[model samples]
Target: MTTRDALQTQLEQGIAALGLHLPADAVPRLLDYQALLERWNAAYNLTAVRDPAEMVTRHLLDSLAILPYVQGRTLADLGTGPGLPGIVLAIAAPGREILLVDSNGKKVRFLREAIRALKLDGVRAVQSRVEDVEGQYDCVTARAFASLADMLGWGGHLLAPDGIWLAMKGKRPDDELAGIPAGFGLRGTHELAVPGLSAERHLLVLGHA
Candidate 1:
């Protein structure tokens, strides 16, 4: 059928493969967000993954895979370029105040438009470096933003005590594991499965040491 239909099927199957259920409107909203990003990408070059089908696997499903570990009522998605997991998470599961942080002006502008166009409540986007942004969140997320040590070092203060940090990375970051800075301990590492994706994907969970 059409390309959009194909992407829709891929997203649906991917969600099921992850053994997660989403609200009826969730899927449509997700596709809408993708469309919006795609339009903006034409002008801003928001993300490297330009293919719609690839976006389904690399962007949408990859983000959805971490849904189980996204705890706490407030979450800060640092270096959330074009709002990868942040926007994806906000759509997949409603509620939980989400802050999408990025240093890029174009990306943040795109993020705001996406938030409003999607009619997403409790979600906001800000243009600021991860380190400059203030306030604590019950959960913090970084998608390969920086080294384990550097990411925690810059944004570690944002994570509330007993909060969880979900660092999304490809393959197990064995080398960077040792660099996890002081006061932050590795909670665990989880392998994520995204349908139609065979490449390695891992999520490093961290908390107070």
Candidate 2:
């Protein structure tokens, strides 16, 4: 089998292990996105994950691990470099308004291309600093983008009064949690077990106190 086919099988198995069901075309589209990223990375260096198999575990499954925690209608993926969970979430969750926010011109350009190529509806990419982004969303996601405190400090305004912030981290950021700004409280911290990946992954769920 080709490497792409192997990656696709891995992705399918990983999604099943997570107890999640996606559309029939979801897996194919996701693989297509990975292919696109691989082609773009050759020129733009969008992500450090170069291996297609590694991308399946590290990028695709890691992002989809938090699919259950994603709530509400609108989501803003702040500092979404190469659209990690943002783009993945858009493809997995249809009919939800997802906005990919990044300040890097090159990354934004790549995100726009992915959106257009994937033919994803109800999703858009904007080039702007997280702190300067306008409009409120029901959910906001940041994956290793910044410290929890700094992330909330900069893009906190973008979250609606009752919105949820899903922050993906490598370890349990107890120190970061201690520094959470006032008015925002830690709702929960979930240990994510991404299939085929053994690294420690935690999902910090935050909301207005």
- Per-candidate Cα RMSD to the true structure, in Å, reads 0.8, 0.7
TM-score (all chains, Cα) for each model: 0.98, 0.99
lDDT of 1 at 3: 76
TM match of model 1 to true structure: 0.98
Top-TM-score candidate index: 2
In candidate 1, what are the lDDT values of residues 1-209, reduced to their tens digit?
A: 88788888989989999999998998889999998988889899999999988898999999999999999999999999999899999998899899999999999999999998999899999998888989999999999899999999999999999899999999899999889998999999999888888999999999988
Q: Which ranges of candidate 2 are over 4 A from the true structure?
A: none
lDDT (Cα, 0-100) at 163 in candidate 1: 95
Winning model by lDDT: 2
Compared with the true structure, the alpha-carbon lDDT of candidate 1 equals 0.93
